[model samples]
Target: MAKYLPPLFTRLYLSLLTAIFASILLTFYLSEQFLQRSDVVDFYEDSLQVFIDVSSYLQRNGQTAEQLFKDDTVLDPEFEILWQKNWDANADCEHCKFLSVIANTAIYQLSDEQLLAVYPLQQSEEVILISDKPANSSIFSGDRRQQNSSLITLFRNDPSEFIPYLLLLIVIISLGTTLYFSVRRLQKQINQLVKVNQEFGRGELSARAQKNYTEPVNELAQSFNRMADAITETVSENQIFAQAVPHEMRTPLSRIQLATGLLRQRKLKCEELVLLDNIDDYIDDIEKLTRQVLTFSKLNSISNQCDHQAKQCIKLDDFLQGRIKRLVVDNNLSINLNLQALQLECDPAYLRLIFDNLIKNALQYAATHIEVNLKVSPKNLIMLTVDDDGPGIDNLQFETIFQPFSRLDKSRNQETGGLGLGLPIAKAATRRINGHLFVSHSHLGGARFSCQLPLKVP
Candidate 1:
């Protein structure tokens, strides 16, 4: 079953809407309760005044309670009078009391859903007064009583009675719509920030979040941009340092090579010649190290600018054959190639750099033979592999070897004249063209450098 998860803004909107609706409902309920209580208190005061008026009328006329009751049955317009002589005969009325206490006036509900107020006459003989319409309808059934009461019957029967509820509905809809758009705007900004952060994490150091000062999220965007700036500056400085150190060392290396060549030309003993050969080997190692460092730094710089770099559709087969032929002449190494006539869209300089590093690394380590294979997949992906017949790399070193300045062993470094930057430069060059480079155990009992690149330019 798929979990029902909502987005952050959606959850926030729902929670806010629910809180608002509940608050409005609670306010309405409490206000209705307060108004009902106020109405009840006013009705009690009016009823007490009416009772006092009846008592005053009997005293002003110089008449007794029994004579006043018999003469005038109706006392006020708001209430009716009922003379009950044998009230004890009714079992329900046995517990009923005279008007000696203010609580004696009680509300009586009839069988036909009508409300009646029953009050004692406060006389010698037992008598009660009743009212068909209570002093306040709210005293009985709260606001619901006003719905059926005669006072609001005309309003309820009219069509316009729905106006208040209709207005309330419109207000709720307007609030919801406003919240929706506001949340959507916030979500869009947040998504943009997230996308930029993801791209930055993926090594696009130039990626930055767009800022809008009018928005609240602009503060976050500002912080993100600052962080990106710091990281990009740091990486650029490091690349500059890497390139600078190599360029400074190259001059001394060239002088050392000249001195060693001149020394080797002198007539010397066998042991002395061997010492000169060792010096020559050491010079070659230093030269190789300088070249690798320069290439590594250049690849790092180019990868950062790959987006604006020009790319060309180059024939892969012809390109590999020319590069292999040149390497063969330089290193006197036997290399086999199985390349297809496929066109690839990439920076030709970077592509040649990638192949040169891989093929040179293979030739350096291979005992007898090296193989280069290039093919296009069904998905239009270019796959290139370079394998050798030397001892394969340890599985653990597959990733370690691609790190700059990483070496498997000191002996291998000395024998191969490598400063462990060939594979790293190759990897960087592959990435410049939106490609991946990885190494695995080759079928020929050696390391296999595999590269996958998209045929279509990105």
Candidate 2:
């Protein structure tokens, strides 16, 4: 069976509230146990003495307690006093409980709310004294509880019993103990999974979740392992193919070049020379494709050693000025550059590669104008954009353009097209520094590529 797992924050918050509630109940219980009440003695307890005095008065006056009760005399207590002769019958009323005997006077608790006393007199007769409260308080005549609070005490259940509170304490303790262990166990398991995921994200392809886990968690871990396995396998195969193809093609390309050189040295017709020049062009394109394949393979492969600098902080204005000055741009195209003074944290080499690819891509596609802008966004991220004034790409092809060897313009002419590794390499560099790359329609009537990066490398 799959175990129920609550959200992490919800469980933590619920645990906190439960802890507070348990603490409050425990504090109330402990205070009630150790702290004394304000009223040490109530009126009912002082009335116990009244029972003894009434008993004594009956014995000395030579009067029966039952007779004293019939006559409204000055000896009558302000409290209710019960003087009954039918001891066996009254005992069945559930009102009598013998407490203790002092000086031949016996005390019995009556009806939970009153006290009684018995004193022996002249003829083996006994006088019973009961402290009076109200008529509603007395239920000494019924076998069952009061039905209407008066019909028979049929509704009576003592409120001072301790068992209910004891039961409640047990329930709270049991629930609290269960919740504590459950949340603790779940947190430990979640932390283990999160740790392995973090290791995998940090380029540790070997990191895998252990099988010693319960349902749902183990199931999710297995899914992640399967995905990682597929990625690792694909990357390994691509690397071998990219490296091997270039090595294999080098021999044929070198031989063809040598043959073309020897043919150029002899006298040749115009058409033959044109054919030789076409062969040279093909060789050059092949060599360029081979180098790009190897670069694409390296970029897509997962590795920790990126030759990234430990201190990633760099001045944006100086870096841009130096790299742009070195680039060989077309003379006819009008270039507009807008820059901001910013100190950014990133691997400068990776940033340089991304910037160079974007600039080259824009230069290749622009008709007459190119715009480059660098600034910081409101989210404290670095936003760098390159815009061109040429035929823009369709919005649907935005994701497709990032794939290696993808080209929108079907014409494979080298002048206007490329092997299409530039954007992919740029995207890879952006991901390495934990950044986002997106393409959209530009205000300049052509394509716009935007790179959004965090201030710090992560």
Candidate 3:
């Protein structure tokens, strides 16, 4: 599951999750601390203001503080006064501590049972307002004390707080979800374009991307389609030229061969006989080049047109045995075969292009020994390898070696280095049959040409 998702997707998933939850938690905490209902705020502020006003009034009027039952003159007061006492000014309470002092009013450290406040009057007396906490109060403090202390309780008492919190949460979640799905859709479209490109690479020149995509992707598809169009036009014209020239030259080539054969039968000097032999060799090389180009042209134009039955399974071991025996008899080279009995679905043309060139090269370059291995892989692939103890190729030349007319062996006389289309033909035909061919350092102290083909054709 971890490997299936792209690295960008995994990183975005974690980052978005952390951002959403962390933003929500930070917003909720800030709202609980600073943004709150008006009445809840007024409760604590009014306590200090009311006490200060009364204390000033008592000093001006020469009267004592009002008692709850005895103060019938006061009506609808904000605080239900439980008790008031004359305390020593500038003296701390024995059991409780001073929380803060504002405008000569000292806020006491409240107890769970009572709300306590102290104020100094005339620098001689401390008037303390103490009341038993009401069970059915309008608010509950965060500290569980009887005083109103927190804004979180606003959610239970007011819809305004909860509504904003819920809306913020919903908006955060919705944005993250939208971004996630947007990227996922983009990745899906990119994957589809990649698949189309693979099909075109496999010789399905008609494969193209559809226009049902979002921007950037749509523009990229258009660019690829334009490039494919130009390449297809160029390749079609070149294929026609390649096929026509070789075919038209065949008539002249045949005439030359026939004239040389007749001239050899007649009485001629020794130099004239050598010239005829040279003409025969030149005709053969041209014929070989024409055949190579024609074979490659046919393979290059493959468009998946083979019928289902054309891809037939054959006994691979038997197929190689016959071909290897014939090649050995013709070349007179000592070659070893390690074959496994396996069935593989293959096109005969592609098989010919692959083994004919591979075995031929081994015979040409090998000093004295050659080996071939044919076996089934654990991945259900048919593996074929040909090894030779010749001057092995350098690693730097591996890529260029598969290109047409590429000969790494520079000092070849007429007997060696046949037209250098063999490796390119083998490589192209490997693609035609949906296989991979690669070169490795051989165990026999030379070059190894390995081909891996799927057991079932796609």
Candidate closest to the true structure, highest TM-score: 3
The window of 10 residues in a row where model 2 has the poorest summed lDDT is 35-44
On TM-score, the stronger of 2 and 3 is 3
Q: Could you give candidate 2's per-residue lDDT for residues 1-458 as a string of tens digits?
A: 23587776566858775776777678777775453221112333444467657767877998777788788765543566666664552554354665556566555555444555454444655555444454655536443232335522433454445454666678777776777776667677788889988887866677887777777678887888898888778867877888899889999999999999999999999999999999999999999888877776766666665545444788987887777767736798888889898887877867887888898888888999999899999998999999999899898999999998789876666676787888998998888778999999999999999999888776
Clashing pairs in 1: none
Model 3 bad stretches (over 4 Å): 1-32, 37-48, 61-76, 80-188, 258-268, 307-309, 330-332, 411-414
Candidate 2 lDDT (Cα, whole model)? 0.74
Alpha carbon deviation, residue 327, candidate 1 (Å): 6.1
- State the displacement of the C-alpha of residue 133, model 1, in Å, after optimal TM-score superposition: 3.6
Winner by lDDT between candidate 2 and candidate 1: 2
The 10-residue segment with the lowest total lDDT in model 1: 93-102
Give the C-alpha lDDT of model 1: 0.73
Selected candidate, larger TM-score, 1 vs 3: 3
lDDT of 2 at 67: 82
Cα deviation at 223, candidate 1, in Å, is: 2.9
Q: Which residue ranges in model 1 land beyond 4 Å of their true spot?
A: 1-7, 10-15, 29-167, 170-216, 302-309, 316-342, 356-398, 412-417, 439-450
lDDT of 1 by residue, 152-203 (tens): 6755666475565666677678898999898888888999899999888767
